[model samples]
Structures are given as C-alpha cells and as structure tokens.
Target chain A: MAGGGDELKLLGTFASPFVMRAKLALSFKGLSFEDVEEDLANKSQLLLESNPAEKKVPVLIHNGKPVCDSRVIVQYIDEAFSGNGAPLLPADPYERAVARFWAAYVDDKVLCHVLEAARGKTEEEKAEGLKQTLVAVETMEAAFKTCSKGKPFFGGDRVGYLDVTLGGLVVWVHAGAALYGMRLFDDAKSPFLAAWVERFGALDAAKAVLPAVERVVEFAKMRQAQAAAPATAGGN
Target chain B: MAGGGDELKLLGTFASPFVMRAKLALSFKGLSFEDVEEDLANKSQLLLESNPAEKKVPVLIHNGKPVCDSRVIVQYIDEAFSGNGAPLLPADPYERAVARFWAAYVDDKVLCHVLEAARGKTEEEKAEGLKQTLVAVETMEAAFKTCSKGKPFFGGDRVGYLDVTLGGLVVWVHAGAALYGMRLFDDAKSPFLAAWVERFGALDAAKAVLPAVERVVEFAKMRQAQAAAPATAGGN
Candidate 1:
C-alpha cells in the first residue's frame, strides 16, 4: 500500500551493519530521506506493519511502500534512484550476481559466526565461535582476492555493493574482537581486506552511515559485561 | 574461473525445492542444459568445487563458472536470457524488489517451518512446527494478497519470480501435508493462494520441473517411516 510520491524513508536502528546497508545506499545515491530510528527492544509499529513476516530492520520505504531486508533494500535503492549518484550494483549480470552472492555469504556464512564468537560466554563456546568466525573471514579473504584483484575497493574505484555490506559489519567485528581481546580480522592473514576496510571507512557514505568505533566497542563491552553478570550471579 | 562460450549445466537432486528453483528458471526460459544428479549423502566433487562456501546443490554452471544458491541463479538466468520464453523477474525495480522480497520470505520464513513440521517426531515438536508453519503460511497469504492484488499470479498472468520460488516448494508442501493427513494449504482459508497453486501447477514449467505428486508422497512416506523407525528402535 504505497502513497504516490517521491519521498524515501528508511527504518533503522543505530550501530547495526544491517541497517547501514539501506542508509549507505541512500547516501551513495545522494537521495535525501527520513531515517526512522527503531527501538529493537520494543520494535516500531512501522517495522511490524511493513515487514510482518520477518519483522526485521533495514526496511526502505519509498512513497509508503516498504522493501525489507538490507540486500533487497540496497538493490531497490540502486533501481529506484538510478538517476542519482554512483550505481550501487555493477551493470553486468554476472558481476551483479557475484556482488549479491558475496553479500549474502557475509550475512549467512560470516556474521553469524562472528556474533556467536563475540557473545560466547564459555571457553568451549568461544572456541567454536572463533573457528566458525575464522572460516567466514578466510572465505571473505578469498572473495576479496578474486573480486578486488589489485583494486582498492570491490567496486574498483569507489565503495560499491560488497564494500557497503562488509564495511558495515567490519566495525562491529572490530568492537566485538576488542571486547574479547581477540583478532577477528588478523592484519597479516587478510592484508588485502584490512587495507580495503581502511579505504572503505574513509568514504563519505561510510562516515555518514557507520557509528564511531568507540560507540561499537562500548556497546560490545556492555553486552559482554551483561553476558558475564548472569554467570557470576549464578555462581554466587 | 570461467571457461569461454555458453554451455549451461545444472547440478541438482530429484526432490529438492532449491534445485527445482534452478530447473524451473531454465524451464521457464526454454533453455536446454545438462542435469547432473548429486548424491547429497556423499556430495560430489563437482558440487563441492562449484560451491565451496555452502556446498549445497542447485548450482547453475555456465561455461565453467558456477552460480550457487537458487534465488541468485534464478536472477542470473533472467538477466542472462532476458530474450527468452518467460521473464522470471519484472522490468521495474520496485516490482523486482517486491518479488525478490517475497521469494526470499518463502526461503527464510515458509520452507523451513514446513520442512520441520513434515519431519517432526513427537506431538510437542509437531505443534511447534505447525505453529511456525502456519505463521509462514499466513504471512504468505498476506504477501499474495498484497503483491498479487487480485491477479491470477504474483506476476500478474504469467508465472513470475515469486511464482517460480513458491511453485518450486509447493510439491514438497503437498506431500508433507499428505504424509501427516493434514492440510497445509486449506482451500477455504487461502482461497486465492489455493487457486493460484492450481494455476501454477498446470503450467509447462511446473510440469517439466516437478515430479508427480505420487512420487513425492512416496518419498515423504519413506522419510516418515525412517523417522519413526529410529524412535521405535530406541524405545525397543
């Protein structure tokens, strides 16, 4: 049920890589839109109404028509606002598929592992988390090598599709690793990805979309502390 | 590592909705390709080599390069052969996104629940499975009503993106329901969706891709027997 107009609105929460997908796409397209901050603890009515099935964030509402899921929203922005700034996806189908594939891999294969690793309480759980996280990171390293070649970013000159998708999560990875005193993206192992992260973070869109590293670390610390508190209380 | 020229090949199993997505896309496009059956019990080297990350089937190998994941492969087919028989995705970006969103919902929401419901052993497990499955079904009904808009299909007349996706899964659903003597798609509740299924199943693409209902039911009966036998043996 879309109201006919040119207005763009993004439903999101702060410090979420998923939400950043939609936000970055909008900034990349140079499209001005209302950003509705959602309290995930008590999800907004808009988020529930728009995405009744998933009830998740990063919903891009164009003229009251909602497009949920980050990757879907990014593609929507690229299509809807093609007349604006840099194109979010590559022109070619294969290349577009490659981008889409890697982004999906990042969500499905990588993010879950890293989040589990970050939030794991026990040493055994953390070990399992780290193992899966390494698998994801190494997989991504291979992806960067093949896709980026010797380019600075996945989109070559600019911060393209995979860059936005991974860039959003990289900050979280950094913060989550800090809380655990671990190296999630070891500089030596994934040197290319390390450099690409630096390159992507310097961009205007990333700056506009991503929360400060300190903010993420603080958030991660709070989560870590909360996770530990329950165990400590139980022990007492 | 792409070998030059356009020779299409699909690696899949007989009774997977994931594989059917690729098959249906090819069938809909009127493209001829080699269909290699994968022994998912012991995965083929080709399946592993083609899709190292996920290693799941329904890999569309064009030339020598592989496109893994049903949805991604489907989109690739649409773009690579836009001049072919039936268009899988819509011309407009918004329409394409809507299709993409709902198709993704089918994968992320509906399919898993139904599969779990089909395979559950105990009454409690089945109850949980049915609850989630119904949630998925109700959500799909809402999606069909919104996206379909009184049209014969989600893609208006012809079987479009969402049609291929849900159509691929419908056979398993029918069999799953039959095995338990339950109704997954109650005609009275989802009358529009019920009619839509009948229309979709009658299409040439559905005929080419789908195995007979009897075959699927036999497969389901075998699975149900295997599941029950394990518990029966444990109890003995």
Candidate 2:
C-alpha cells in the first residue's frame, strides 16, 4: 500500500477548509491523489457510502478504504504514507501528544469561534464570538511558540500535523478580512502566527492547493446572500 | 522512558468519566500511577498549571510533563508504554484510524448526547437528547461488528482503543439504568454491546478503577438537587 501503485482519492468541495486540510496533507506528503469534487448540495453516493456516520466531505479514500474526518485523515496520511515525505508528526511520543493537543485546539477553539462569529444571530453575539476568536488566536500564538520552539515551522523547519491542521484556514483569514473587516491574526496581536501565516502560505505545496482569497470571499458572500434569502431545498 | 522507572501522576476528579478513561488505559496497560484526586470546585494550582489551556481534568503528568485531555493521554499511555502490556491500538494504520474514528464517535455522538440528556433545560429537549443517544448507541452497535470482526472486543479478543474509550461510559450505563430505568444497551437494541458491557465491567482491571454505580447515581442526584437550588460559589 505504501508503494507508488497505491490509489488515493479525496471526496471534497472546493471551499471547505476541512477539505483543504486533506488536500494540504496529500500535497505536503508528495502523494498525488485523484481529487473528486462533490456537489455538497446534492452529495455524491460515494461520499454518503464512505462516511455514513457524518455524511461530510473530506473523506480520503486510500486504495478504496475511506478515512473520514480531517484530523483522522491527516494522521492516517502521515502513518500510511510514512515513506513518502518528511514525517508530519515528530517521532517522540510526548511531542506527538503535544501536537495532537494543539491540533485539536485549532479545530475546537479557533474554528468553533470562527463559525460562531459567522453565524451568530445577534450583533452582540457575533461581536462576542469575534472577540473570542481573537482570544483563541492569541492562545495559538503561544502554542506556535511552544510547538515550533523558535523553528521555522511547527514540525521544526518543515510543515507537520499542526501546520496542515491550521493551514486549512489561511485563505479564510484573508477572506474574513475582506468580508467582515476582521483580522484573525495581526502583526501587533499575534505576530508569530501572523508571520507564520505568510510563511506557510508562501510554500509551494500550500499555494498549489489553497483556494484563492477572492474566490473564497465570493463564495462566502454568495452563501451569506443565500442564507439571508427565503428557505429552499438544498440550501447547503 | 518505557522502563519501569517512569514517573506517572494523574490530576483528576473521582466521578469524571473522562478521568476514568485515563485510569482504564493505565490499568489495562498494567502500569501504576499516582491518582491525585482533584477538588474540581476549587481546582489545585497544579491542575491549573498543568492544563492552562482548558484547565480541565484527566491531565496525565508523565515524568513531570503534562498531557492534557483524556483522548491524548490515552494515546500517550499506549505509545509511552508500548511494551508494558498488549498494545491498546492495533499495529495496522488503517485499523488504527478505524479505532480512532469510533473512539471519537463515542465522545461526539454518545457522550455529547448523554450530557445533553442530563443537562437540557426542557423536558422536550431532554427527551430529544435521550432519543439521539439511543440512535448513537445503535450506530455504535454496527461499528462494533466492523471493528471487532466477530471477535470479543473492538481490538479483537482484547480491549483496545475503542474499548478503553467507550469503557469510560460503562459505569454510566449502569448508573443511568439505576437512576432513570434507562437501558442504553439491551438484548434487543444492542445485543453485542449489551453483553460487552457486562464482560468489560467484570474485568479485574476495570473493577479496580471504575467508580461504584450506586455512588455515581447518588452523585447525580446530589448534583441535580444542587442545580435546582440557589446559586453559590464553588458549586462545581
């Protein structure tokens, strides 16, 4: 399975950051996979069959075996394709645990608040969510220091699990600033993460997979307009 | 670090199912550790320092390094003590991913609904939570067959990652029955899991650490009564 003959396919949408995480991992690992785009409004049978539990995108099918969830898929890629490229996770058990903890934080704290800010019903609630998102960013700024240890990247001079996990949102940061005048990370507030954001975005692998900021901003606007309109079938 | 000289300490509360997960992993791995019970109401400085991000329990301190979160701690225990006992996670990468997927299902689908059932503000909401929890149980029943492959456990003939993960809720299953006449798993609803509930609970390793069922029921009742009472400081 680790050989070049392995068949890897990803079922995902273009705009999903979660799906982007999977693409980023595959790109970083230097594994060429068939990118199968799914219409999220009317999901594909492959996506449904692959992940009946969540019925969500970002299902990485490696040689016909499906790995669902972005975090799980990233770890699966690192483990299954260990011989492909530089390791996404460090070898030390303790360091691996630390990476896992912060990766989970990226989704649980940062992404959760980002969604809340986007979807909150009231102005006050959205403001609070934005405030907490910044707080989460500050926390991750500290985590970037702890995990990177003053190195160029979280995996210490190479992108790793944490980088790919948070990297899913790099384009969204730019789109967010364009849409809501929000800056998730800034030079004054989260200098390390702000710098890392640019450094990470500049990488050839990341640049190849990350959606363009204008495209994401347009997509977000369309979704917002759709959400504000009357309810209809296949709203997602 | 895999030697017998490893220093392990756990900062946790008695009744936390999450903390019980770490204990179950340690006990299954045949490793001994200091169980430093925490006053969650007034959490210790050690707890605060150990887990500054969430400040929650089930923080496993191994050789003075803190590993926060039950899921992370369990994996750390397995990797750090790989030779101490039978491996908690399987050797195969795909199988490991499957185990992780279901272990997460236990928390996201099962535990989340269980908490909603216990904490929902209205009767309708609580009933909905209970309904969803049962549906999740049925989903896991099918997952057990997929992972176990007609074997005794999710790890196949022995407790593995999923077992230890869902094992945290075994006591709660019994306590729920006593408290609300609720059978989360039954002969008809989930025959395999119903039998597994009994088999897993009877293990010496499990009995050694699992809190008594009656004690949990009493604790739940006390907490419910407290919730109905007036507000006060340090209520947790």
Candidate 3:
C-alpha cells in the first residue's frame, strides 16, 4: 500500500519469523509498505542484488537504501518513522539497555537452543535438545518475572520492539517443538509466560501479519524429514 | 579517581575480552572505579549473587544496581556518564543502527567462528572452522571499507563504543588463531583490516589496559592443552 514517492518496501520470505518481526513493527506503527515475498529456495534477483553479502530476506528498502538483519531493520523502522506509533524503545538509558539486552539474549540464547532442538537427529539428540530448550525457557521465564513489573508485555502494558522481536519467534518455536513431539510451554509450569503467549496470540496485528501456524508446522516437518531422510537412506 | 558518591564498580576476569570492553569504555571516559578481578574458575559470592542467571563476570554495578552482559554494560556506562567522555554512539539514528549491526555481527559471526576453531577436534572440523573465520573476516573487511570512511578508529579519529567493543577481541582473535594454527588476519590479504588493527592497538587506552599479547597467547595455549589433556590421558 506504499505510495510511489520514496516508498517503503519489505523483501521477506513468508516463513521467516525475522520477516514477521519487521511486518509487525511496521504495522504497529501503522505505516504502509510494499511487501515483496522472496522465494528463499529460488531467491529473486532483487533480493540477491539488494543484500549481496547475506542474500537473506527481511531487507527493508527505504529511499533506495537497504537495511539488512531483522533486529537492525526493526530499529531502523522505529527511528525512521519515530512519530508513527509508540516509541519502540525507552528513553532512559538503563531501561533501554535492559530492552536491548533481552532482545539480543533472545537471538543468542533462545534461538540457538531452539535451532539445536529443531535440527536434532537421534532420539538422544532430540532429548538433549528438548532439555536445552527447557533451560532456555526457564531462563526466559525468570528474566520476565524479574523485569516485567506486572506488565502484560516485555515493555509493560503495550507491545514494544522487544515483544515484536521475541513474539515473532513463538510460532516457529511451537512448530519446531511440535515436530519433535515436545510441548515446551504449559500453564502449570510457565503460567506467566503462557499467559504472555496467549496475549501475543490474541493481538490483531500479530494475527494479521504472522504466517499461519499450520504453514510453519509444515515447513518444520519438511526440514526435519529432509535431515532424517539422508541418514535413513544410507542405512537402507 | 572516582570521588565520593561516584558509585561505579566493575567485576571482571583478566582473560575475558568481554570484561575488557567495559574496562576500555570506563578508561576512555576517564571514569575511575573499584576494579574487582574475578576468578572465573571460582566465581566470587558477589558475582554469583549479582548475576545469578548467567553468573558470568563483567558485571557493572552502578549505584548498587548490577548490569550484566558486556555490550549492555558498555551502553550503561555510556548513558550513566554521557557528559564525561567522547560520545560512544553516533548522533544520527541510521549511523547508530549501522554501528549496532556491526557490533552484533562481531559477537554472532566472528566470535562464533573463533570459538569453533578453538574447539575443533579433527582436521576437517578445524578446516571448516577456519573457513568460517575467513568468511567472518571478509564480511568485517567489507563493512569496514564501506562504513569507516577513512576513520582511524571506527568512530572517526577517536575510539568509540563500536571500536572498543570490537577492539577488545583483537588480542583474543590473534591469540586464538595462533593456538589453532590458523592465520586469521594476514596483512597481505586483509590490508585494510590489518591497518585498522594497528590503529586500534595503538590507542593509549588499549595499550594500557589490553592484556599483553604474550599473556593472551599463553592463555590460549593453556586452554587448548586443557581441552586436549583428557583425551590424551585416556589414550595413554
């Protein structure tokens, strides 16, 4: 829905949670952007040309300059259109540091463990993966408990940049865990986190832009099967 | 020489580059604090209590509040004492985003490759690790070429937050590469990167606080030996 004069454009793959991150941020700000879906398997010329080094999607092109990396893109969007929506980050230095810390922690710790679990091959490997995932979840739960101050989202009452970044990954995590026949979040164990998940899920912006859960599940299943297929074929 | 009522204390270990990041920032800003060197092998009760979750060193305690993570600690220092030193981050939002991107890239790509190379058990693993390291180096070189704009340091003549964050790891990278028998930064191949390295190393602050190269080399050797010792003893 972006207009012609120096319009905003987002190049992303549908399945990427990273892409969802940018989408949610832009939408929350009520900014219009042209969503150009890139086929990751057969990457478009523009996608490659725009992001030559990484050649990965979720590239935001504004006034001909491209910004790569989801977190970077989110920050860019927040700054470029400062007046569009609520401030993505707090103004106070300590609070801003806390927000950035959690965002980076999500990338470093949570995603690392989740990816390991998603890619586990053997039963033992899968079990170990699940254990690590649980550890990550517990750590996140603790972080939230300490930092939340009774706010519904990471930023308190309303969803902010941290929530957008972390919330986008929930679908992928659930899908990956489902593929491994593991349930990572439950009310009994992580009531607050579970409530948070439900609250995020219920948001209109999230529901509108997020990829269908079924599609994510399918993609995860395909990835796991492909990984297992090669090893199983060798046995045959 | 932090005077009365200046409550800044840094808990860190000698060998950690992450800890050095906070130290360099503090030094650059000319802020004095009580430096607590932690024995990482046996963390102090205060460190354990301060950073209960990660329990890692490089915890910056300002006025009784603890800030964990080296990058976050740097930002905290920058914000808490903004008026004291050269601005750590750029005033422009876009430029700031670019800086944060590079910082995150260093942590994710560069550090990951170095750690992998350090832990590789076989020749194939080592080779793969080296290849990844080269890719990271290449990416950094490209970023520097585009973004540095002939700036001596990352922050145009003065060493800023990005430089300190990345510069802190130079000794470790050089030493770790040597320990793994890999040439990570060849002057002939990475001239710009090599020059930048020299420039960063020449900083008075860096010269003062950076652990001696020989010490880093010895540390890497010790770590590698410890990793291999158990397997060698088992073979015997």
lDDT of the candidates, in the order given: 0.80, 0.91, 0.78
Scored against the true structure, residue A86 in model 3 reaches a CA lDDT of 86
What is the iRMSD in Å for candidate 1?
1.0
Query: Model 1: residues >4 Å from true position, as ranges?
Result: A1-5, A119-126, A223-236, B1-5, B119-126, B223-236
Candidate 1 lDDT, tens digit per residue, B1-236? 12235699999987888888788888888887899988877898999999888899989998888998888999998888877776788888889998988888888778877766656777788678779988788878878988877888899877888988888877765775676666667787777777787888888767887888789788767656766686756432
The lDDT ranking, best first, is 2, 1, 3
Q: Candidate 2, which segments miss by more than 4 Å at Cα?
A: A232-236, B232-236
Q: Clashes per prediction?
A: 0, 0, 0
Q: Name the 10 consecutive residues with the lowest summed lDDT in model 2 chain B.
A: B227-236
Descending-TM-score candidate ranking = 2, 1, 3
Report the lDDT tens digits of candidate 3 across residue range B39-135: 7767899999888867888998888788889988887787777888677877776777778778877877887777676578787886787688889
TM-score (C-alpha, index-matched) for candidate 2: 0.97
Residue clash pairs of candidate 3: none
Interface RMSD of each: 1.0, 0.6, 1.8
Instruction: Provide fnat values for all models in the order shown.
Output: 0.75, 0.86, 0.67
